[model samples]
Target: MLADSSSSLAHGHKGRTGLVRILFATRHSLAGLRAAYTGENAFRQEIWAASVMLPLALWLGQGWVEKALLMGAVLLVLIVELLNSAIEATVDRVSMELHELSKRAKDLASAAVFLSLVLCGGVWLAALWHRFVPG
Candidate 1:
């Protein structure tokens, strides 16, 4: 007769252990959100933007749509910058040679990041204007 390990009481204990493992894994996964948006200049800029905007948002009595737009803009820029940095890091890791194509790719990625930041700034300005200087 084959032993039914799947139905064994030990399997129940294993399930509990798996649940515990998943919980810790989830905690770490959530922690990655902070890291995803972290960099020297990137963090500084994000903090500055938030510091300036948070108060304005509160004062404006921002509705959900405005809040979403503002948050979405900031997050989009930060996430794009993070991805750009990652791409550069990977490219550098692969080779340190001065290849034109690699340099061009990196520059393009950097430009994309800058564009996202610009878009975020535009969104911020529009939100602030609408809040404080409504027509």
Candidate 2:
């Protein structure tokens, strides 16, 4: 009876250790996934856009500089979008109410996103024109 009780206690300790290990692994995995998702949206969208534009830019861009600028514009838009998201998140965390300052801040962040998108479009058009049919 004594030996059996001692073995049971050791078994219980092992069980506890295993549970802790599993929990730690799960936590790390979740944190990694959250981080990946945070950046994944921008990366996925930009890559999709590139899939459409890479060939066109390669053919239509005036030179390496033009190609670089076109790609860089897309990256810049993504950066701005991420920043805008961060701003909205921060505002929401600060307060969920309909405050004037929160509204203004979100609106401003949205405007910045729009401006970056517009710049991206303008760069693409310019690069395409310069590459396909220069002035």
lDDT tens per residue, model 1, 21-59? 688678875665466546447655766776776566555
Q: Give the number of the best model, judged by TM-score.
A: 1
Where is model 2 more than 4 Å wrong at Cα? Answer: 1-47, 54-56
TM-score of each: 0.65, 0.62
**Candidate 1 global lDDT:** 0.73
lDDT of each: 0.73, 0.75
lDDT score, candidate 2, position 40: 57
lDDT of 2 by residue, 21-74 (tens): 688778876675466455657545765786777676666667798878877787
